[model samples]
Target: MPAESNMSTHSDPQSSETAFLEMRDVVAGYGNTTVLHDINIGVENGQIACLIGPNGSGKSTLMKSIYGFADVKSGTITVNENDITGRSPQENLMAGMSYVLQDASVFPQMTVHENMLMGGYVFDDDSQAARRAEELYDEFPILGDIRNQNAGTLSGGQRRLLELARALMVDPEIMMLDEPSIGLEPRFIEDVFDRIKQLNNLGTTILLVEQNAQKGLSVADRGFVLASGEIKFTGTGTELLNNDEIGRLYLGG
Candidate 1:
């Protein structure tokens, strides 16, 4: 049995001051629609924090708000204690943050190597991008094997792997992945999660939104449950997994 956790309905603002990524009292949405209200969450450095909720629960909106895709009506978002509210996506990427959207993002016409190079477009020197791609290839040898193949020709799993590797070009301090396992085959799902753990082992902090609640919480260091755009439960991953109420309501027990 998993040990119990101090699951709280609301986050403690004072406790999150030192978090690597922190959002406080943030109310965000697209245009005039407010999707999130008084959202408060924190992710520690080198930790895998996951958000799991039902559809339309604003899980994606929360991520979008942090990555500058949604409008923040109030409050602040900080990374490494530096305020980054309202920063553009490009600015966030330059500041050691990378976001992988839920939708398929590979460029069909581009070769695997070319797609990898695109990930490093922010680099001032072309040689630097090449070097980074080589390093990633060493880490993900399968990508190296398919370097010459057009991205459109790759299988679903291959495209997913490419997306993950490409995002590593900058070696981001933190990576935000939304529904990474969605649309993947069972075999590929495990592979994706394994790579996620590997990345964490190599010092990349992760903030994830996954529809597979059990799988997501199983690997997460910390977990948050959002409903109706508000955080309803916060605890260690094991705690959330073991919580009877959580399992009954969210885990379909």
Candidate 2:
């Protein structure tokens, strides 16, 4: 079971409300390569926060740092009020955070059902994990339909769906998605975003890095613009979408 986190009292007074997840002056990198420079971002409880920027802007790196895959040289990362900086990935997961990376992270040789079982690896009880998998299958019926097929044999979109279904096994409070719409067809991309919205409606707070700025912002409550490892803009999704500078710079105006 994951720890029940407490909400932080310290917050930016200018903001309308306190955040559920916050990164304060975060300076993180991999090895000697500094990717995120003094990054500060936050996501409120049950809201979908989207990260958008040009390639190499460190959007993914910021998400990686939150997932504990990158090294934090300074600053702090807090979930609720817990300082989770420098924690291991497993530690973060146990603290009620779930991360889905940009790549196809499924076990290619395993059946879809088996791959989903891997998601609950953190839980000691096998029966509980199995129950969770069944619950996700009900939520994502396509996954249930092809549960016996080998993961590698599925289509690109199906694979992505499996990856998402697997991540839901833990019923995480905060779900960090890295480019969830990356390689799907137009219809499948719509489906993916729809799933994201549905998850948000079900009370999961989301933080995601997306290449499709227009669609990403459309589904998000808040949007962030990162450039060269720094935050350039922060506002409601509609505000950024309507900003001429943001549209010209990132939204393919």
Q: Estimate TM-scores for all models.
A: 0.97, 0.93
lDDT for each candidate structure = 0.92, 0.85
lDDT of 1 by residue, 1-253 (tens): 3325467867733237668889989999999999999999988899999999999999999999999999999999999999999999999999888898999999999999999999999999999999999999999999999999999999888999999999999999999999999999999999999999998998999999999999999999989999999998888888889888888889998
Candidate 2: where are CA atoms >4 Å away? 1-17
Best by lDDT: 1
Clashes in predicted model 1:
0
> Which residue pairs show backbone clashes in model 1?
none
The 10-residue segment of model 2 with minimum total lDDT is: 1-10
